[model samples]
Target: MAELPLADYARTLTGDIQTLAEAEDGSIPRTFTRWALEQLEESGFVSNMTVAYHSGHGVMVYGFGYSDDRSVLDLYTTAFSLDPMVDRLTKADVTRHYRRLLAFLQKAGSIRGNFDQPTEVHQLCEGVEKLLSNASKVRLFLFSNCESAARTQPEPTEFQGLPVEHHLWDLARLYRHQTSGAASEPIVVQFDPPINCLSVQSVEPNLSVTLAVVPGRHLAELYEEHRTRLLELNVRAFLQARSTVNRGIRLTLLNEPGRFLTYNNGITATATAAEFVEDAEGRRVGIRSLTGLQIVNGGQTTATLHHVFKRDKKDLDGVSVQMKLTLMGSDDLMAIVPSISRYSNTQNKVTLVDLSANDKFHVEFERVSRTLWAPPTTPGGPQTRWFYERARGSYAVEEAKQQTSIVARRKFKAENPAAQRFAKSDLAKFVNAWSGLPHLVSRGAQKSFAAFQANVKEQPPVIDADYCRRTIAMGILFKEVDKVAKAHDAGSHKALITAYTTARLCEETGRRIDLDRIWREQQVSDAIVQAAHDLCPLIMDMVIQEGKHVTEWAKSSKCWEEVSRIPWTVPEELAEELLARPVEFAVDTREEEEEQLSRLKQIELSEWEMLADWARETRALELAEQQIATTIAAKLATNATITAAQVRKALEVYDNAIEEGFSAFAP
Candidate 1:
């Protein structure tokens, strides 16, 4: 079924939202869940009544709701309520509901929202992070569109950029880890090692980054058409432009590909050069050149501004720019970054980038700011520095003012150490403001037992039973069982709960393998439930990577593992990492016999697979002649006339006999 159109959700629940949100704290009950959900109709949100599972808190029952056109903004979160040892909701409860709902939503899509919740308060933000991780599960669920004979679906991607090669790097790292004491090791490995991808870069003057799609990461079904559209409509145009150049003169341009090309960031094009010389008035402003390289459409000239991404193409022609760019290449070269240039894109988003100069691809820009005192540093150096400079130039006081937003800090780090420390150190004040909780925590827990013991020793004698009892409360003793399981059968990082789920989801849904059976057969079924554990960050990754094409999340950590591995190398045949092979020898005697029999049968079956019907008929004729001789000999009560000698003589006129081709055994 199609995903619930976000529009309808709003239309149905218009005024009723306050009832859902403002219900007397925890007043909503299971009975009301269904009624509220009926209002949702096609919305993918599940209700508390729909789920019955064990959660960190206790046995959890959940009900869900979502916004559609009713959302007014044309977007709203998929709402959910949890009945974990209770009924109804609160802010914290809703947040937890959102976390879980986000997990399920991510099972098929992408999600957007700040990790607004404090990380130190609890694992809520972390859970949200895990919930939002490599969210290909929802992506896979959306693969339903691919199964449709009606419309072609988009290809899967690491987010939506980072082509297969870029993905390959991540994949390489994943497979390296998976095969090297991570996931199940494979026997064969093929790779182009030590390769770095310049898939991500921040644009100059803006600090807006361009994230390239990982090659092969996007399944052909997810956004193949978009990519194809970019290629056929955008990439093709660039290629066509380059091909049109008379002799060494080359040119290609796009007024602006809107939205898609623009994406989460506004900048759209990148340029590079063999050498960029910031020449002009003594003032060293910025790279400036002639603006408005117009395009003639139906005899009407359309003004289009281009940014130079790479400059090494064709002698790195032109001058008057303050920055001298020479030998402009991909991100690997220090001369450039992977980012989009602004204003150049007014026509379209999701535009295909024009690539030129066999070895280099960059943005095309105009000369204007020839003096800024800053020389173009490679990759994102210029833009990052410029952003800081730009901020100080425009709003020094406001920029310097104390800010509490996490998103702000993430995007723009403060130059001053005091500003940097404000988030971590000042947080205690906010934490203490709460009445019940005592002391605060950092973003990370101790990685080792000694560290944990040290933390315990420092705590006051009066411990919060709530904290220590959480272990017995949840019944999830990860540390102890892990060691026991390791002693028995030690291969699994069983800790990476999400990847296992991803592997299973891929297997079960892809019809490639059965994961449940494997789980049951393994010694540690509890260990395998790591799916939801890793869910948070993976979903976050999906949203970060995708930006908007997909937004909304659900499912557990296990699902994200698949998304995380998108860039890594998994052999099509083996379906595991294609690097660092470590093999295990297994001898199943009965299985070996069965395999040998299958091989033999296959050889016999090849008789038909390899031969034409007439050759079979010719053999039949030879059999009939031998039978006829045998019949005549029986009538005469003597030796058969068609003896082996006679049959051999008749068949060997040319002396060369036809032999069956040998069949090779398939693994």
Candidate 2:
């Protein structure tokens, strides 16, 4: 096995650092903090989270500790990178960090400006106090690029008797993680005897599930101890945004405590491993401790229960929560965790991309990407490879470990010609660019990515080898156009320029040239290259007419969308303006010229009708027509919208849709 050098490993672990020593400069602490978080999220310890730097009271990174309903961070957390910033990371430094954290927590209740607290700290003080006041346990994570040592004070379970948990992500732990990408050890919790009674049975090899009726208080305590780490990443990603669901769950608990269990579907949770306290006859009496506890579903319900108990001071004396806890080997857990999260909460319309991290399609794509290589760019040169990271951290792990046991850790990036590598989002842009809808390509990456995913699910054939080749060619063309445009000082309108130019050129070339053949040859034609170089100035002029302010016009994707709807007559109009002056790829004969004109006119006619239909339906026709005529002296045109019948066929192909359609809203 090839061992990755520290520099390569560090680069893989943290994109910003080049060498292990670089991490010593206060960078590794923050980088490792993120890496540990990724491990936590992947291991079902926490949900997908965005850390806000400089938000947590001079802390480097701060956000909600948990993913479910308890999103508010009561645990005032921070990290100190011990490099040049500090000569040594001693117990004293750790103590001061915690002291600063406690001092902030103590004054969190009142936002009074007694002393000059940073705006971030003052703003969060009141909310932190409220979350902590109702909190069963608060946790402070002190991440550092330093060795772990004895604490100045005994590492107490409680801070001033408030049940505070301390977690240290020190340099040694980080070093092991960086080298091997090992998982964070699961937090184990022992169940009290007679724990609401349960039945257990093996479901698969190394997998057993227990069915039980757990008390609301028991569930609340568990969530409090683990916070958001209890929820699976998908559930957290779905529920992290503040919503009215929290209030609704709280109201139900306070007003109709008896109906809460019935109203809520309870929780589907998992554990990496489990132990049972058995009776004399070997009957399972109670669960001793569950390692790596994670709630795959019902995050909202758990958080709501915790919120009601903590914030409202309400007693859950008679409340109970239905629990389905599955115990599986850590290896098995990785394979099916996302699937569990996907099907667990049918009530929420979770976006497919969020649910698609472990999706077979992505897996297959990664396989194809790694296996396929472009022919050597020069004779005897090594064939170039494309890396596709189906899951996060795949590249670093692969480089360091040279393995693919974890689907989520595979990388999809190539070392040379870095721009050739495509992430899922970039793949979406490439696909959209060639789907007879370059307008979608110009809309922006996020929108394009969502659209592309819908296409993938609705159209599996969209990702075959031929399609991948075309996407690579499109990337090549896009990059070249961008390079050419920048050379001519095109500025912000560069993308807009590249997009329309490609669309119209593709339209023109299709009449005489076979587009598929170009991709099949894996070669960008000289004519196309020439066209891209020649078209930059002309497209810039068109953009100026449509948008006087180059900056605003360049940034306006919405404007580009409107412009693309037009029939794009500029190519033909420019040709006509130079008709007498022999154009390089001009129609050589009368019949050929007529044929090209006929196709353009046909396209223009259809575009006018489509524009009119779209305009009549949405009143955008007038605006589209105005932009087109003003910019290129053409009518707005668009590809026909997908018909309902076609959509039905797609649904049938995928076998998806609500089997039993119900009313739009429950009465």
lDDT values for all models: 0.24, 0.53
Model 1, residue 267: distance off in Å is: 47
Error of 2 at 239 (Å): 6.6
Segments in model 2 whose C-alpha atoms lie over 4 Å from true places: 1-16, 19-71, 74-89, 99-139, 150-165, 175-187, 193-196, 233-240, 243-252, 256-265, 334-357, 371-386, 391-397, 400-461, 464-667
For candidate 1, write residues 339-441 as lDDT tens digits: 2211233434422222211111101000111111222234443322111111111122223232346555334333221111111111221112111111111
Candidate that would win on TM-score: 2
State the lDDT of candidate 2 residue by residue for 8-94, as single tens digits.
443343443323224223344444454455444444344423232333353333433433344334342445343422334678777
- TM-score, per-candidate, Cα-based: 0.17, 0.52
Q: What lDDT would candidate 1 get against the real structure?
A: 0.24
lDDT of 2: 0.53
Candidate 1: list runs displaced more than 4 Å: 1-524, 544-667
